[model samples]
Target: MKAELEQLKIEAFQLLNRAQDSSAVDALEIDLLGRRGKLSTLLARIPELPVEERSGIGTLASSIRKELQDAIVAKRGQFSAPTSQSLDFDPTWPGHSPSIGHLHPVTAFLERSADFFASLGYTIADGPEVETATNNFDRLNIPANHPARDLWDTYYLNPARAGLLLRTHTSPVQVRYMDSHKPPVYIISPGRVYRHEATDASHDTNFTQLEGLAIDRDLHLTDLLGTLEAFLKHTFGKVKVQVRPSFFPFVEPGVELHMSCLLCGGKGCSACKQTGWLEMLGAGMVHPTVLKNMHVDPAKFSGFAFGIGVERMTMLLHGIPDVRLLLSGDQRFLEQFHY
Candidate 1:
């Protein structure tokens, strides 16, 4: 019986050393140590022997099973494939370069635009995209019955609440700010605005607008023009701006501000509709009634306000032909803007 136990251990080690994979080692373990296996069969035979001889044979079988299990475990390790680092690695070797990501083009432009205004003593302010008709229109001199409200053609969130809706412009932030603050307020509100409009190369249903509002004892159209000029020059590097008479309910004597097409340098081009000029933003002195609606005495304080379309500015600066490209998730288009 002791000789049989020694032979079992030798057979288990030979099979374990020849194991090509973990599965072969597992099979060998069951053949050698499992119930009814060689070691277990020998242990079972011990019960039929005399008590003194039974103890010796049982001890030898247990020892043989233990040694076989250890050999199987060690052999399984030898069959495992080496890790990549263990097989081929140098401590001084240059590592694989990882690709880094950057901000979206619109976000990049928004931050730079805010920075330009922030440098000019304007504090950035924000308000909700979902707004009330009173703040968006009534407080902006565009009542429910007013024709100017048609110009916005907005998206209504609820039929109740005097027409709760996604704000058509960032001007509501100006109204919200004035409702809580007094005169000498300087704020620039940059936010997403919604309009119920058809998508085109030039227009999008959703876009960004940066609204500027500054109120003081005396603020004039000249101040508004000068501010717009400085902003345009700083943003576009010395571009010509043209302001023409326009109409907007929120501001009196509203004017449309334009810049020479950066693509054409004022020469006729398809992007500018062969006109060589791009309408950049709208600006004017705050209407007295709009101030009165905010409960700020219009007679004591006057201000200038302008709303600049951020996407339009991005298009002009980057020479992007389609406004849709700004909203498109095409990585090729977006990856061009690294900084």
Candidate 2:
């Protein structure tokens, strides 16, 4: 019955659009919204609906009916006699443009990055956001007592059973991928990650991360640096990249990848903390333990892996001041990116 109602609504709108005169619109209004109309017939069946679905179906039916009525009114008004010849305005006219739909900023950014990697023969990998402690931590060379765990405090959906929790990074996808695949692998894992942390303009409890992995014979730190540089240049268009020594359990000789500040043109600003470079990617050669955990012999296969905040890159690319705005459902904020 709900599906029938939805179909009826669509039919009503189609007929309404074909309405060429006030009389035609008036006929449609009565046929679709009158006491004996199609919508009225559906509403009459509300009591016949199942107990749990009654309220929801009725509400949806009501909303559809209301929209149909409004559309009818607006349609009829278009054919009605113009009250005045001055043409200054008409109170009943709808001046607002219909909303256009497009991809969310974060989704757009992820797709853009994925395309870049895909062009280079890297397959996209995926994993569940809810991950096991072993896959999320131990597989990445991070253990229960590892200090790095503190940096990514996360929510556990079921603390008492299996230590299941929301993954704090997309890197877990790499672990899952390696477990099932062998050497000569190239993939990018882009997905939402949860963190039990404070929300700010720059940070959120949940955000997107892009994990990059390339495991081919004779791959080196230079290969990782070059790939990152190309990605940064392709994404930001000629931006400078900096690599500094860093630490991540999953990677040996871990390094942080930084790009010149877009906000200040690398001159330095509060966004860059007076530093010309803003840290973008945490990357290095994959550690041997991580390979062993996934049943891949490190001696046989070596790879470089990196993770970067997708939303952070979106913010930088578009000069968006707040990370929250990327996910916020504000039409005004979103429509600005129609480009």
Candidate 3:
């Protein structure tokens, strides 16, 4: 029994010395000191020996076990030295750069546009995306027969609430703003809007619209033209801007603003359908009925309002090929805009 104990002590020391790593040291410790280990097995046999012999063997076993445990711990420390040294990174080493994020192109445009308008004394205003027909349509002078009111053209929220729908444009904000405030209102509403329409490279069922409204005495089409031209020049950096007579329910003599296409340098392009002009936004003198509906005197005050599609502006600004990409949440597409 003493010979076997001596053999175990020699074997344990040899294994511990050869252990080059923590895993190897762990295996050696388990083999020597575990419940079913060599030491435990030999200890269990102590009762089989003569009473006087058991005491000598047991003492020897305990001493050898403690010596082996101490050797394993020391060996493990030696194995860990290289690992600890490897962790002492050079203080001057260049660290890995962290990943940075940026805003979506639409949001970036919205912020810049807000800043531009703010510089022009236009306060930002907000309203609910879910709105009533009175604010979304009727107050804007859009009637029941208007194409926009059709279920095919708009999203209705509740069948019970006949007029409840997701706002088709931020112009509803203009109505809501006028409802609660007196005239001399100068504000821009930039927000998400929805349409019940098909998706394509140029069109989206959901997009952003920025509506600008200013009401005071004697506002005219010329004033509308000048305000929009200043805004476009600031946004597009001195581009050619023009307003042509057009029609919108909310504007008495509506006009659509057009800018020369940057793609073909105003010569010609598919973007402008072989024409030099790109239809940008709609503006006009606010219709009398719209003011009357909001409890503002149509005779006492007049105004000009305009609506610009933020998605369309973003696409033109970045030369993005698809409107869907603006809201697709594609990190690859968005990472390109990081400044």
Clash-forming residue pairs, model 2: none
lDDT of each residue in 1-339, candidate 1, tens digit only: 788778777777777778788998888878877886777777777778888898777777767777777787778768787778555877788899997999987888889989989898999999999998888888898888998888899888657665799999999999888778888988999999999998876689999999999998889999999999889888888778788999988889899998888877788676677798888899899999988877778889998899998998999889898899887899899989999
Question: Where does candidate 3 stray beyond 4 Å?
Answer: 1-94, 147-152, 267-270
lDDT values, one for every candidate = 0.86, 0.86, 0.84
For model 2, residues 1-339, the per-residue Cα lDDT tens digits are 888988998898899999889888888888888899888887888888789998889789879978987888788778777776736777788898987788888888888899999988999999999998888887788889989999989998865697799999998898788777888899999999999998876678999899999988889999999898889888988777778999999999899988888888878775676786788999999998887886777888889999988887898999987788877789989988864
- Ten contiguous residues with the weakest lDDT in model 2: 81-90
Q: Clash number for model 2?
A: 0
User: What CA root-mean-square deviation does each model show from the true structure?
Assistant: 6.6, 17.4, 7.2
In lDDT terms, how accurate is model 3? 0.84
Q: Which ten residues in a row have the lowest lDDT in candidate 3?
A: 145-154
TM-score of each: 0.72, 0.71, 0.71
TM-score of candidate 3 against the unseen true structure: 0.71
Range of the 10 consecutive residues with the lowest summed lDDT in candidate 1: 82-91
Against the true structure, candidate 1 reaches a TM-score of: 0.72
Model 1 segments beyond 4 Å from truth? 1-95, 160-162, 267-270
